[model samples]
Target: MNKGLTAKGRATRQRIVVATALLTREKGAAETTLDDVRAATATSKSQLFHYFPEGRSDILTAVAEYEAGQVLDVQQPFLGDLSTWESWQKWRQAVLDHYIELGQRCPLGSLTTELGKSSAEARAILTTLFTEWEEALFLGVRTLTSAEPEAARIRARSILAAIQGGVVMLQATGVTDYLTAALMTSTDPLRPTAEGTD
Candidate 1:
């Protein structure tokens, strides 16, 4: 999308996306309008349309992508290296903390839910996010276990599912118990065994 833009053009486009994302997170996709975005970003209507020719849908899609990146960005450092049990715990805590901070309003979840019904592009963006997130967990699982590739893949998927389910529950109940339990139980396969137990 940024194929032939000058540095300033790219920055302005990014500024719009970032501001729109923040607005959506605060007021929700349905509530956030193009005018809201323009006012928030201090961009003229022409400039907003220039960056997002398709209007609100295009802007929402961009915000969805931005929120997707944020899902992984928060889990950094620990998510980058989950080779050890300690590292995995840190990642788990990071995930929990992120959701707690977000509370019931998950920007990515809300954006995808709002747009996925009407836009294939939005669904694709969500699919890509899940694929990359699961792959990162798979790499970490492989690092921590002697499981075969297929087993590691299954384990990683389960962990990802657990996390997603927990997040949903947390959003619904305003409780973190489900997420905590899911993270703890999902990592059981990687728990250290007793001495000389094979």
Candidate 2:
């Protein structure tokens, strides 16, 4: 249970977060005013301030956390449990399909950019998100390769870096080839060796 939240409190917070997420996605972080959030969530100013004392920055931070969760949420069971090649493929497709559908506009990207990704708080949030995401990929890679766990961790970081760089290029160009190449190339080395007539 989340210690800070009563059931109703939790529900209200979720409503605010989801509403903020949609507004950010649709309007970009720059244009999503507190009034917009208030109207979208049907939340009173007092209630919004009660839940987030720091107002927009606080809500933006919370929304960033929410969006971070969402980035992987679409991958579902495959992202959670990647013990098989089939699961990896599914996860890959989910990630690709998600960005493809989203096109150049990325709510999460907008939020991070608006919040100053270089800031200590923003970096910390991103670090946590990437850490968790890389861990999931690391486990799958380890399972597939039977390598040292640490090796998998290193590879996972590399893979994550590649994917992030790819996503940046993708957002700039409205192209997905960079993302696809990043994932494919990162995992290419992990492909099992097979005997051939040579």
Candidate 3:
């Protein structure tokens, strides 16, 4: 989207995207309107149109990208450096905490739900998020286990799946137990006591 724009223009667009993301978080992507985004961001209709030429769909797409980035961003520090058992535990807690806190209001969940109604682009965005998340977990698993690379990869994917499944349940039931259990059990195997070590 940012094919060519000056620093100021990019910043303006980002501001709109961020505002739209927040609005989507509060009021589901399907319900948020361009007018609401404009009011929240204080951008005029022309300004919004300037940044998102295709109108609401473009803005929603940008917001989807923003929310997707956030899914990984929250797991940072621990997610980026899961070299030790402690880091893995912290990463698990981070994931659990995020979902538990948001519960039914999960922005990614709502955004995907709405986006799923209209385009394959939404599915692609979700696939990309999961793929990246799995890769990170895979790398982390490799660092702590001497398991074959393929085995570690499967474990990583399992961890990612556990997270997604737990999140769905959390959203449905407004409980953290599901996510906590999923993360704990999925990550317990990589604790370094079972096989490999630092």
Task: Write candidate 2's Cα lDDT for 1-198 as tens digits.
Answer: 236879999899988988888787777777889999999999999999989888888887888778887877877889888766667778878888887888676654554565435246656776788778888999887877766988989988888878777777777788889988998888667655211111
Better of 2 and 3 by lDDT: 3
Model 3: residue 148 alpha-carbon error in angstroms: 1.9
Query: What are the TM-scores, per candidate, against the unseen true structure?
Result: 0.86, 0.81, 0.86
Show the colliding residue pairs in model 1: none
Task: Provide the lDDT at 31 for model 1.
Answer: 87
lDDT, candidate 1, 24-62, per-residue tens: 766778888988998899899999888889999888888
For candidate 1, give the lDDT of residue 105.
74
For residue 116, give model 2's deviation from the true position in Å. Answer: 6.1
Model 2 off-target regions past 4 Å? Answer: 1-9, 115-120, 193-198
Model 1 stretches with alpha carbons more than 4 Å out = 193-198
User: What is the lDDT, from 0 to 100, of the residue 17 in candidate 3?
Assistant: 91
Candidate 3, 1-198: lDDT as tens digits? 987978999999999998888777677777889899989988899998888999998888777788888888999988998777888888888887887788887765655566544356766787798788888888887877756899989999999888877877776678879888988899887765534443
Q: What are the Cα lDDT values of the candidates? A: 0.81, 0.77, 0.81
Q: Which of 1 and 2 is ahead in TM-score?
A: 1
Task: Give residue 35's lDDT in candidate 3 (0 to 100).
Answer: 91
